[model samples]
Target: MSARPSPIFRNVSSKVGIIAAFTALNLATDYMLTGLPNVKFMDAFYFIATFEFGLSVGLPVVCFTRTAYAIVNPLGAAPGFLIVFLVVGDSMYVLSGYLSRTFRLVEKESSAGDRVLSIGLIGLFSALGFDLITNFGTGLSMVGGSGLQSHLWGALVFGLITMNFPLPLGIVHEASDFLFFSTLVPSSLALLSRSGLITTGPLGRVIGKRGDNQN
Candidate 1:
């Protein structure tokens, strides 16, 4: 007899429902925080979803949530290139989340301070990487039709560092991500764990009472 398919793939509709729900939550937070220049909970949501449901669910959730937010943005729909850049940039969180789960980066047995630091560092690196990539994309878009071959690197640097000189948007974005990841992500995970939404499983390690060595 053939073995049964994994539970994750067994109920397609439930996964869809979960993805839709996360997308809605992300969009709602984005709308509510529209006034905040670079601060938003969408990234945190992506991380949280990945933490809870694993990468299989997190990937679609990030794509749908980001695309919908871009289309329904309060300012306006993003340009096609910008939309692509944003999606690619935001995917850092998804990758970090998956890595954290797979490798037990946030150890359940670790002290609170250590866990917080680990999570914060993850956020910091992910945010920095996201900014670097998207900024390069933006720079390329700006200079692509200008035939400025010699200025490509300068344009990329402009996007990353000196675009807004005094207080760069990238700085604010990175700071907010670090703060949110340090505080919000762990707190939410603990709440979910307590609520039994995140439990020990064979797919990978999770942030709960069990140690990695146990599994």
Candidate 2:
């Protein structure tokens, strides 16, 4: 009989599976909330991925999920570069999550108030960052052939115009991200940690219990 794959291989396989599952679920949730008022889970899900998987895995998965979702997106993927812009926005969430871990910016284990406050701060900044990245991408795409100064001016102009969509919608989305992240992230990390599917990293201590990165 063929020898079973080594424990390391099995572990890596499982992590990939978890990543794929989470990505699918995130997209599914977005689809379900399609008609809701800024009720999508994209930012919150990215926080979970980065919290569970870190930058190396989380960032690539964000890129993949955004691109895949865009390709097969049901509501029609208009503006062709929407996927790229969304990926850029999702990357902000991943980077924000990783930065928290890297700086020990968020509490690992603390009071509910403290944890909520810390995560809220992260979510707030992440929302703003997401808006900036995606809006900036949208802006750049519109002025691709312009000179550097014009490009800069165009980006700023378009970014604001883009952000004006149902202005309060942005606030609602940020609030949703904070609520979900505060309530779900720590618990998910613990459950996945118990399952031995995720690992801690040097700069970012996730679980900080069992395994480290396979790569």
Candidate 3:
């Protein structure tokens, strides 16, 4: 019998490839969308993680992607703001991914009613959570004293608007996410079918069985 690949080896190779690809994709998209400050596409990566890879993968992926972006951008006049952005942004994405996964709201196979409820709740919670956490962090890191109040108000307004309306940047983020998942999920499902992990069937019927027992 041929020797099997060690689990550690297989896992390392698989994760390395996946993470590298994801990082490249994240960077490329950020670059392409840089001209349009009103539009951000990297949010799609987080959405994809939540939907496809589950919390464990999604959380780290979001955090790392945000950290990478911060490393590249180095935002704000103060270096401290840059540091806070990295930490706070990463934390927000991780929280969003974990919440989405825990709530089972981002599941691809959810019903319409479920979809509406899940997406609405998840969006509200995520937007608010990120806004609160990041605002506080930003205030602490960059601004001082009464700046916290201003930041809090800003977060609340930004969170409410972005979560509810189609702000230009938010639109781009959501559209990219929808497009990415629309393509990726079908391909994944197809691969699963071919690999015998899943099977297609008629409504209310199982595959591989020619049944006429509707009596």
Strongest candidate by TM-score: 1
Q: What tens-digit string does per-residue lDDT give for candidate 3 at 61-87?
A: 666666666667634233545555545
Ranking by lDDT: 1, 2, 3
Worst 10 residues of 2 by lDDT: 1-10
TM-score of each: 0.81, 0.77, 0.53
* Stretches of model 3 off by over 4 angstroms after superposition: 1-10, 74-81, 107-110, 113-117, 120-125, 146-215
**Candidate 1 structure lDDT:** 0.76
What TM-score does candidate 3 get on C-alpha atoms? Answer: 0.53
Error of 2 at 65 (Å): 1.2
lDDT of 3 at 54: 45
Better of 2 and 3 by lDDT: 2
Residue-level lDDT tens digits of model 1 in 95-190 = 888878766778753599989988888888888888887777777766544456656876687576653566677778878988999999999888
How well does candidate 1 match the true structure, expressed as C-alpha RMSD?
6.8
Predictions in order: lDDT:
0.76, 0.69, 0.48
